[model samples]
Target: MNLKFIEKILIVMFLLTFGIIWYDFYTFSQPQLNMNPDLSYSRLLEYIKMGWVKQVDLYRNNRLAIIEASSPDLGDRSQLFRVNIPIAASQLIQKLKEYDINFDAHPIPQKNIFIKIAYNLLIPFIFITSLIYFFQSSNNIPGFPNLPGGPGAFFMNLGKSPAKLTESTDDTSFDDVKGIEEVKEEVEEIVSFLVDQDKYTLVGATIPKGVLLVGPPGTGKTLLAKAIANEAKVPFYNAAGGEFIELFVGIGASRMRDLFVQANKNSPCIVFIDEIDAIARKRGGGYGSTNDEREQTLNQLLSELDGFKENSGVILVGATNRVDILDSALLRPGRFDRIIDVPLPTRLGRSEILKLYAKKLSLDETVSLLDIADKTAGFSGAELANLLNESAILSARYKSEKITKKEINEAFERVIGGIAGLAMESGKIKTLIAYHEIGHALIGSILKNHDNVEKITLIPRGEAKGLTWFKSRGDARLFTRAQLTSRIITLYGGRAAETIIFGKPEVTTGASNDIERVTEIAYKMVTVYGMSSLGPRAFIKLNKTRQFPYPPKPMMSVKTRIKVSREVHRLLKGYEKIANRIIFENRIIIDLLVEKLLEIETLESSDFYNLLNQYIILPSK
Candidate 1:
């Protein structure tokens, strides 16, 4: 819950308590008379002219009003009024002596308003307190709405772990997760351990104390962890890293203690944390503020992990894509013990994921899963799943019962960052884009080392106004230096083709991404792979480098960094000049290809190869 809602509920409780206390006070103050109705004092006084029924006190402020009655029957009920009313003994005795009813009012002198406040508002204050206690006691209630989006500013623990309850409501299992056979086999080892702890224990080997599931988000890291518990028929306690921390200084540490205590009781179970980075981040990296709750939470977690013996039945499982960002202390040899790397799904894995999500879809004859897997070379398991789901939506939108290849292609475009909207393109611009794409395909055809360009389309996907897709015969792997350079030349081929044909630069800055791709290749070739004639020394890493690869120490002088940058620009310029020459000599092919693109806005790889038939003869040795 959020702070706003909590405040509202508190206000409501205060008002309710005040109302109940006031009602009780009025009830106790109702007038009662001891005289018989026929011999009433008011009636006798009326004959003598004192007629008003004034000051009928059921309660005295500090003491009971001691009326010197002719009758002697009121003493038994006297103590009851003393306890209920604000009352003193001396004041009652004085009233009887003077016969003036000088009873002390609860003497709430301006000096002692605190006492009167306690007496008058005690019931409401107690009522408000009990309500607060009731909410605190029911901390485990799940799925409570927080006031929109603050920390658990709502009631306690409501939004914390939708994980445990989702087990009953969420029917997903291991079959839904795809890829990484090695990692799945590793997780199953833990499952086998949980199934029969005695089998491993008899040999003096306690089951591995903890298993950390590490991978990129949407790669089924947490899903695989949950499936292990579901398959074992064991309980699961799931929480986010952030959920354990709160604003109260040591509240996070307290909650960690509580979580582990409860988790240990349900032994032979799995405790999974999604996004462990929030709690397990390398400490002392954050600002050195005194009230750093996340650091304290991490400290408590380290304590809990250390507290567990090898024989302890509880298993700790954590998932995070940014394994590098995690603290080395938390991932030390004995604590996390095993760090399983979950990678993106392979083609076969994608096929399986597609089939699973497509179980509810009506697939047409041409909607081949293998073809999709081949086309989607770089998609992760999650992307493929999303592709299938989007295809189903497209089929429904078009009012087709069966999902078709066309719809699947459209869905692929959406998954790939969606089509560049129509408002962003014009007819002449479309023709230019089509020809520019064709230029890349033509160059790809002539260059024996280039991967086969698959499809060239003016209909954009992602932010690009046009795209040229290429496919190699096999699975995607790290690109070789030669392959990387060839790819960059092909990227620049579009803009290069425009200049060679139109005798001017007709292409737009859509080639900005193309130039960026080219620059990286040049940088990598020179700095990382030692592919350049410049030899293998670089001032920066290609992986981290916006400038170069095989990064050198940053302690180097600024002049060295600038020189390395100059070398990168020089390398890109060399490739661009050579690529321009290649397109210049083959201007006829570029022209014909553009004519064909103007006629047809999109063309497949076969169409490209067919048009460049004359230029396709084997390159002379």
Candidate 2:
């Protein structure tokens, strides 16, 4: 029986026993009386003295008397009267004898020994039973295996692994996974090994025990694991790294052990732990230093990985975006033999992903997936899926039959910037927003190393009053100093335009985000990229485990820190001056662009560049 069910039964039985005992005691103490008028002791004495009493029956050891008497009120008929007799009723008995009244004294009935014992012991028995239940609930008592606090408590299952076992099926195969051709190729060998272990073992080559999938969030790390399991055609136990952690001591380790035990029992299976960094973080002082439970769980996981035999047939696949913070023991050769990086999709990859998702949507003939892919350079596979989903939503919202290029473009803007908000009315704020965005487009277009302007609009989107997008020039891996400096100057353009048009005192906080980006770029150039006059040296050591909003303190001396700050400031000032000079020189074109932008509320790259071409020559790379 379930322990909780048994506990309920005991409670009901105790209540029933107590009720029965109390009912018996109440009946024994007060027997049912006859239907007679109650008389006072004085009235009874008067009746006896007047010779009106006929007979009497005493009960409860002379404490109650039933008297049969005749009086004028009774019309000479004998009537029974009940009276509560006093302790000293000898005189009443003598009077009854003198009156020749027939009296009989009934003895008190004896109670059952068991009922007496039960009535007296009910409270103590309840107290003792409660103590037993309390001790058993905490699992402190022996010989009570089926009680709470014992081994049978409901919470005892907390130590069990919460991994969901997925039977091998062709529901999700590699064909469904798009935009990661290289990553698919990397794991194809593991699938082959799981299919026919003898193929590799015949040549005396051992299979890798584990594979680590590292990538940014939403880059299809978990999807890749599913694909591998489906291709292998084996039982897949999927669990999150956080599932093994518990508030109770040793529970995390127990869960970790249970997970692997089940994996080993079902040999030739795959165990995929997503977000492994949650438990496999680097040991010792840092973020998880105070969490001994997580440390012990990680230790247990390492032991299980090490215990795997060359032919155990249990392949472990772990995924995390923070591989840098994982313990060295967990990532060692035998533990996580192969480390696969699933990076953001490239241009061609994005196009493939878009096409795969576009198959489900009712797209217009002019809707081009390639064009949308080109605009989304750094989008991951999941993000690409969302873009099409958003486009379809917009199509439905507008009651359109099919998704057109216009819907896709709007969805792209929505995804990149945020949801479009109400457009600002024409006034000082609108003019200032128009000038700010135009300044960014103007500076970006004139820069020799910066990306080309894609679009500029005064329509508010997300938190900004206006927006300007720059077209990415493919997936450029390395950036030059000229390119970095161009980006910084472009970021400064908004603030410079605000200062020039409205004066420094009237400049709005619209450029706050721009100022932050400018500072980050300038600081990176001086402290990280070694592109400043302070010599080619990195002053700030990168701490992968360091969380944001609380970065690790700089290790440099006061003089070095002062120099780094001055260099960053100098970089920002120089870029600001350059942005001001360019904007001031092209004030005529700026004014023209702002007027056209306010009227149409939007300007494409071609239209923007065409207007600029009539004034100044566009810069060459």
Candidate 3:
């Protein structure tokens, strides 16, 4: 039933309950006074004899009487009183006749048949129906699977696996994916295994039971799993790790077993678990630290992978951003033998991804996918897709016939900087921001290792009052010490410029983010990259509390810590000096760029390059 109808039923039931209570209170509200046997019999006689008794209701098998009387002391006022009759008063009917008092007798009341039926049956039925409807219409209870239908269906599905099984006939396949060539190659073997399992068995080569797809989020791990299933033309079962767990402890284990059984029935099938870290977290966490349900579920999953007859034609594929936290037992050779790392796409890969998304859009021929790829160096496949989607939104908003290159770039800006037209500040703040951004752009233009400054804007975006974006020439896999140092110098350029223009004390907190990035890079160089005098060892300790990959903290003595701190300081100070020198030498150019920035609010790479060409010779690395 619809919620509105159920609600009306509930309201009617509530009103009925209230009306019954009120009617019951009003009907059974008669007042009575009690008197002992001797006194009651004497008063009864006196009232009847004096003709003051109007009527008497004999109850309790004639042993009790409710007398409606008018006594001398009561002065014609009718009073309702109860009196207990002695068994010796056998002539009570005769006494009533002699005293001329009207009398009646009644047995205890039996409830009305309709009220009895309503109380014993109808109310409970309504209550149960309403409860079932409530559970059905409301959102899923925490830790419960979102089972469709009513309460019966919910309870019926409670024990069943939450994994969603799909046939390979569905549309997603290798063609739907792009940018991850190596990942596709890694999983292609699984498809071959599923397509012809007997061929592998005849050659005495066993198929890998599990393929662990590890990467940062939005790198297409789940999509790759689906594509593998589609290519293999096998039944595919997809489930998140969290869905296996519930408020009940053993339910997760039960679910894992059920999922395996189903996959086994549909042999040559693929089972994909997204975010496996939810259940596959390392076992033996400290006392009271590990979740029993999750641990049990993980144990069951391990069993299903390599416990018995090797699961025959079942291929298990798991994906997680944090592979570090997974149980080592699950990662061992037999379980997840092939560990496929899906890193962020390279420049060419990003270009491919853009092309894939662009095919659906009415993109202009003038719009260069290669250019957009260069601008989005660190973007993942999913991010690129979202960028295209946002661009389409912008196109629709402007009522444009085709998605222009300008819309694509604006979409990029919106994704990185929240909303457009948000940066509307003016005057001194604007001038300071202009100088800061121009300083970075000028230094980047002068440096050979640094990427070309793509665009500089004095208008605020995100948390900054200005921004200087550098478009990558290509995806550089390795960074030299000179390149890292150049990056540090570029970071300091903004603060250095502010210090030169407004003096040391007047530098704004806008450079705090820059300082943070610089500190991280410096720390990584010394401890992780081992570029410092400290040694070619990673002395930093990884965080044990979390599974998300983060830079390790240094595990060192106080004296060594002080030494590392000194080195990092020296690096930052030296870079700052380089930045200051650059700013000091290009003071006039900085003023001109700031003026141009203030007037236009934004400058493209060509604008900055033209001005740089007029004043300075480009340096060689």
Winning model by TM-score = 3
Q: Write the per-residue lDDT of candidate 3 for residues 1-621, one digit (tens) a residue.
A: 577788788888888877876765555443244532233678778778788889888876788788887767877888777788889889999988877778898775555776677788778978896776756675454444434644445665666678788888878888877888888888888888989888888988988889999998999999999999999999889899989877787888899998888888888888999999999998877344238888888999988886636538888899998877788999999999899999999988999998888888999889999989888888989999999999999999999999998899999998887665566567787788888898888888888988888889866666766788888777887898888988989999999999999999889998999999899889888877888777787757544322213554457888988988998898788889999999999999889888888888889989987887788898753
- Taken over the whole model, the C-alpha lDDT of each candidate is 0.67, 0.85, 0.83
| TM-score of structure candidate 3 | 0.82
For residues 160-254, what per-residue lDDT tens digits would candidate 1 score against the true structure?
33334233235656666666667788888888888888899999986766788876667788788888888777788787877766666666677
RMSD of each: 12.6, 9.5, 6.9
**Candidate 1 weakest lDDT stretch, 10 residues:** 79-88
Task: Name every residue pair that clashes in candidate 3.
Answer: none
TM per candidate: 0.73, 0.78, 0.82
Model 1 TM-score?
0.73
- Candidate 1 lDDT at 42 equals 31
Task: Report the lDDT tens digits of candidate 2 across residue range 1-621.
Answer: 354765885697688786877778787876575657789999988898888988899888788988888899889898888999988776777777777889999888787886777767765676666655654555532322322355434365667776888887658888877888999899988898899899999999889999999888988988888888888888898888887777776888998899899999998889999999888987884544237888999999999988999978999999998877889988889989999988888888998888888888899999888888889988988888999999999999999999998999999999999988888888998999899999999999999999999999987788888999999888886889999999989998998888898899988999899899888878878877899999889777665422232354676899999999999999889999999998999899999999999999999989998999999898774
- TM-score-better candidate, 1 vs 2: 2
